[model samples]
Target: MIRIETPLTDETVERLRAGDRVLISGVIYTARDAAHKRMVEALQRGEPPPFDLKGQIIYYVGPTPPKPGQVIGSAGPTTAIRMDKYVEPLLKLGLKGMIGKGYRSPQVKELLVKYKAVYFAAVGGVAVLLAKAIKSSEVIAYEDLGTEAIRRLIVEDFPVIVANDIYGGDIFEEGRRRFARIDL
Candidate 1:
């Protein structure tokens, strides 16, 4: 398995492709629908909403409460579509990648192509397994949003699959076709 630590450089992003099995290490910021909306609004007003996203990976998630001693609670990926509205602007701002489940809208896909950004997917509903990789997590913004607040998480060998690559390859579509039973 390939390992990726963040502040994701362009060269590192170029090495990644759809279907690559990766073990991600280093820091990632978590943001979901509510936080995303706030961030987008902040961007619109030409104000910094906290956190420098350039060359960073954004994990679409809202984790549960940590079970004492744990750095974070079950932190699996959230649905990708919910964050679609925020993707393009961020992509334009040098955002290198996204980590979430399911598909993005056509416009988001278009931005992925235009900006050569990529999207990765983590296992859905597998929070326990997902949380173990998080070595640390802390709130960085949107504190009043609670769990929906933005958090910076330090991870060690977090497992993931590249769902969409910069070249427009899509694992979800390919997998569905590969596993489909066609009637003869």
Candidate 2:
């Protein structure tokens, strides 16, 4: 598995390719639909983003309330398409990585290549398991949005698969082609 940390550098991004298995560490941010909308609006208004986005990774998740001792509750990746429209603004701010489920639009895939960034897929149906990787979590913005609020997270070795890479690789498309080659 390829190991990568936050504040993803351009060199690291250049080497990543679609279908690469990854174990991510260090800091990441959370933002569901609501938080994304707010962030996009902020960018439109020329306001500063809630957090420093330089080379940062954002995970599309809306974590549940944690049990007494845990840092976060079941943290699953949401459908990435929901945040698609808000992506360019973040990308412009130097955001380099994203983790979520679902395929990205073709335009977004091109954007990844244009920005030298990557998108990853965190397996679905593994919410509880995913939460274990989160070492710490705190609401950094849009707290009023509750579960959809933006959060800053310190993660250990979080598992993910590179779904889109700066080289214009798209795992979803490759998977489809592979399946097609296998005559039923």
Candidate 3:
């Protein structure tokens, strides 16, 4: 398994290819639909984002409340296509990586190549297992959004798969083609 760190560099993103298994370490941010909207609005108003966008990774998740003595709660990836509208602007700000589930829109895929960024997929329905990787978590913005709040997370060896690569490769399409080739 390939290991990568958060705050990905262009070289690191470029080196990743669709279908590559990666374990990411270091800091990552969490945000879902509500927080994303607020962030885009802040950018439109010429206000700085609650956290710096440069080279950062944002996980599309809205985790459940922690049980006891846990850094984070059940942290699972959310559907990524829902954030398509907000992705381009974030990419323009140098956001390097994203983690979520499912395929992205064609436009978002194009922008991923254009911006030298990659999209990762964490298996869905594995929230409890995923939370174990989070070392710490703190709300950075949009607290009213509850689980949808933007959070800064320090993670160690968080697992994911490269769903879309900077070279314009997509794992979903490949999987479809492979299934089609099976003489079923």
Candidate 4:
């Protein structure tokens, strides 16, 4: 069980190659479609974002409300394709990684290769299980957006699959074909 800490150290990112199963710990920020748009706009306007991107990993999710004594509610990965447009520029700004589910576009794939970034896939659904990993959470930006707001969450043993990696390797495609039943 590989464990990754936030502000992903080079050693950590490098260790996270394609096809690795990892349990991520430390702080991760949540930003879905709406929040991503606002973040990009803020960057375009030359305004400093509420959080730093360097060595950071953004988790794509809009989690449910937590019960008392819980750091966060059911947290899970959302589809990542929607955020493709925003990732590259963020990558250019030193964003090293992202955590979400589903496939990404060629542009995003290219950016990953160009910037030596990685895309990790958190299991879709299984929110209750996922929430168990989050130790704490706080809204850091776009509060008016409610659950879609960006939040910084500290986690422990957060499970994920490395879907895409710096070398341009993609596990989803390969895994799909490898497991698909073919009647020839």
Candidate 5:
């Protein structure tokens, strides 16, 4: 497994390949549909994003409120495609990695190469299990958006797979190709 600690550099990002298991540590931000929409809109209006996106990773999640003694609850990855339209803008601002469930569009895949970024797939059914890796989380923006608020998370050994790498590698596509025909 490749262990990546952010802020991710171009050299670090280039070394990653699709299908590698990874343990990601350091700070990652959380933003679901609503928060993403707001961020893109802010950019459209010539405003800066809520956080400094340079060399950052954004996890697509809207975590459940922490139960009494927990840092967070059920911090599963959301479907990444829903946030696709919001990606390039963030990438332009120097975002480097994304963690979520599901595959990315072809256009999005192309952009990853153009901008030197990667997409990670977090296991979908293991929300509570994943929350254990997040040492702390705090809402940093859009509190009124409730669960969809942007959160800053400090994680340790957060598990994920490199779903899409900058070289056009896609684990999901490779999986389907590997088993689809049983011919090769």
Candidate 6:
């Protein structure tokens, strides 16, 4: 298993490949559709984003409210394709990694290669298991959006798989092809 920390550098991102199991630790941000729209709007207006984009990772999740004594709740990945429109602009701003689930659009995949970025997939329906990796959380922007609010998360040994790598490898496509040959 490969272990990676946040604020990934180009060198680190380049070293990853599709289908690699990764344990990601350190800081990542949370945002879903609403938050992403706001961010894109801010950029269109020539305003800066709520957080710096340099070498950051964004997790596409809208988690359940934490129960008492918990840092986060049910923090599973949302459909990655929903955020496809906002991805290229963020990638251009030095965003290096994303953690979510499912396939991204071909446009987004091409941008991943162009920007030397990678996309990681967290297992769906396993939010409770995933929340254990979050050490702390604080809302940093758009709190009015409730669960969709942008928050900073500090994670430790969070598990994910590289779904799309810097060189244009895509696990979803590869997995489909592999399964198609199964003679069951």
lDDT of each: 0.88, 0.95, 0.94, 0.88, 0.96, 0.95
C-alpha-based local distance difference test score of model 5: 0.96
Clashing pairs in 6: none
Name the lDDT value of residue 171 in candidate 6.
95
Quality of model 3 by C-alpha lDDT: 0.94
lDDT of candidate 6 over 23-75, digit per residue (tens): 99999999999999999999999999999999999999998999999998899
> If scored against the real structure, what TM-score would every candidate get?
0.95, 0.98, 0.99, 0.94, 0.98, 0.98
lDDT, candidate 3, 1-184, per-residue tens: 8999878999899889999999999999999999999999999999988988999999999999988888888999999999999998899999999999999999999999899999999999889999999999999899999999999999999999999998989999999999999996
- CA lDDT, candidate 6, residue 168: 89
**Candidate 1 lDDT:** 0.88
Instruction: Count clashing residue pairs per candidate.
Output: 0, 0, 0, 0, 0, 0
Badly placed stretches (over 4 Å) of model 2 are none
Which scores higher on lDDT, 5 or 6? 5
Candidate 4, 110-173: lDDT as tens digits: 8888887889998886989998988888999999998889999988888998999878789977
Mind giving the per-residue lDDT tens digits that candidate 1 earns over 127-158? 89999999889999989999989999998999
True lDDT of residue 89, candidate 6? 84
Question: All candidates: CA RMSD in angstroms?
Answer: 1.4, 0.6, 0.6, 1.5, 1.3, 0.6
Residue 134 of model 1, lDDT score: 92
**Clashing residue pairs, candidate 1?**
none
The TM-score, computed over Cα atoms with residue i paired to residue i, of candidate 2 is: 0.98
Against the true structure, candidate 4 reaches a TM-score of 0.94
Quickly count the clashes in candidate 2.
Answer: 0
